[model samples]
Target: MKFATALLLIISYIAVASAHMAMLWPTPRGGFGTKQYNGRIHAFIGYKDNVWKVRFPCGGYAPGPITKMKAGQTINVRFYASGMRASDIKKQPVLTKSTKQFHQARHGGGMCEFSLSYDGGKTFHLIGRYTNTCPDAYFKWPVKIPSNVPSCTHDKCLFVWSWTANILPQYYMNCADIRLEGSKDGKLPSQSIQIVDFKNRKMNVKELGDGIKHRASTGPTKKEISGNLSGNIPKALKKA
Candidate 1:
């Protein structure tokens, strides 16, 4: 009887933990729960030292397989902010409410960027860019896979989603495992940097607003597909 009581108390405490956002489409929390879509949020892409998360390639490694899609493919990517159901993102205040206070000081609106990796999780080129305003529930983003993509038989190319927080100085990065079976228009970029931003630098929220600086090297939009993101591919990777 005592053990049962302790267990209940522990569960209650866990239920009050700080709430955060998660990816719903490539369903991570696909397991089972009232607040869980399928399973726990990005079980593989865990939090970083500062409570944020890893960048592209998600700490330079592949997490787990959710699903696979073809290249040059147009798909609607979905997101689940907090709680188990899609509607929970709208009622985020409920999950964020703790005993002492309500964590309603911020909104989930921010910048979402998608990128595709050709050579495993080593490097990635931008795919699509999404911007949202506060007091909005914009979750789905349309994306087109690069028609000219390489195939990965044993290994997996990465589908990366990076969210730059508008509410805080931190950001979250997650990776999806996918195997592409197709040809390439040309070679993938070989010489790109790890992104020009607050990475490895001191905490500067004001300068890192939105956390992303759209560069000429990326094609984060639909129309930009015809044109490549990085200038030189083989060269870029060589340097990388």
Candidate 2:
């Protein structure tokens, strides 16, 4: 009798412990819940009086709030997620093509003016104007491009590009960001592009162009560029 009573007590203790443990559910509405983000998948189970939360390595909470499970409901959570880098937040192509036309104009104080286009061939916008002063002669104005623009869709969408500016005399350069929005149907393609960073240092347009072209390539021709600007820009530009 003592042995049977001890066994019953042990089982009761296990049941109590299991009751305290949180349970995960696949769906919040009925059973446990599931969520996914950044290529990571998570399964959630809820227990009465138990609360759960998950965080991304890049420093952000999952899309939803903590889930609470009622008594007797088991929460199940699943997600196909990956780590997102700070640089990934800014990866998008700089430009689809050399849409800007070269022009010379005069600004106040006899400053030379230049313009370029964010669109492939739609419109031309002013880049900057500079005075002929020796110190000011080599100064380049910084331009921030919009976050969205349209580009041909092959497989995965590409967005964002960045480079440092080279101060030059008589010659001026410009950078732009283009952002694209998708159609309401969720089938139509949209794009966004922009110049996220600009500095007085000389920019390697040729290299930047080549990097974009490589990314633009399909199949075996596709190549990856070094630096966070290229790596994260495309992901940031992707729709949620």
Candidate 3:
């Protein structure tokens, strides 16, 4: 019995380590109820693996609740990095502290995009993009809706969150269902995001780094907050 229990423990740890980030707010389809572990309020909606993420759009989730949002408004979207709720994690392991706990892996913070798809997941229009220091400690992001985005009350609107890891050849995506209230202008974005291809294309590490360097500016300082990080630690990211 003891040997069997040990095997179970090993399996559990491996499951956690393999899984990555997922959306927490606005409620994606299937309503954050993945087959794996649940987060603070709901289970994470990330794909089981990198291949699973790229193989399907919106993590292959069905439509859930519809968030009625207005155009040109900035809303804070929440995420669970590494399938563990960021709120329940520490920057480092507990050997350095008295408390015993797990830490979320940042993966060196990569480029993230918040795109809108009026026609399901067919095509996505780039609404907001962030580089360098995305998915910070809290894993919550501020995304602004473009005033030119047309309302989607008549049909369904898919709000997608895509991230390309800078250090690893990993890509994560989560999509939410939203019903947009028309803006004063009531126009659509002139161009769609060309770079975000839904094909089974995974960007190599060199490509990810090049994209970051190309768009590099006086962006947020890179914070080394991986669970495996040792030595000096930076300031805790302010809560969202």
Best by lDDT: 3
lDDT scores of the candidates, listed in order = 0.43, 0.21, 0.52
Worst ten in a row by lDDT for model 3: 225-234
Give per-residue lDDT, candidate 2, residue 20. Answer: 12
From the highest lDDT down, the ranking of the candidates is 3, 1, 2
Error of 1 at 121 (Å): 3.6
Write down the TM-score for model 3: 0.62
Write model 3 residue lDDT over 55-157, tens digit each, in one string. 3566565566778888766666765444333224333111222133234344555666677888887888766665656554244456667655677874558
**Ranking 2 against 3 by lDDT, winner:** 3
How do the residues 48-116 of candidate 1 rate in per-residue lDDT, one tens digit apiece? 433333333453333465457776576566554332333443343232323432222123345555676
TM-score for each candidate, following the candidate numbering: 0.55, 0.15, 0.62
* Error of model 3, residue 198, in angstroms: 7.9
Flag the better candidate by lDDT, 1 or 2.
Answer: 1
**Alpha-carbon error at 13 in model 1, in Å?**
8.9
lDDT at 11 for candidate 1? 40
- Write down the lDDT that model 2 would get: 0.21
Ranked by TM-score from best down, the candidates are 3, 1, 2
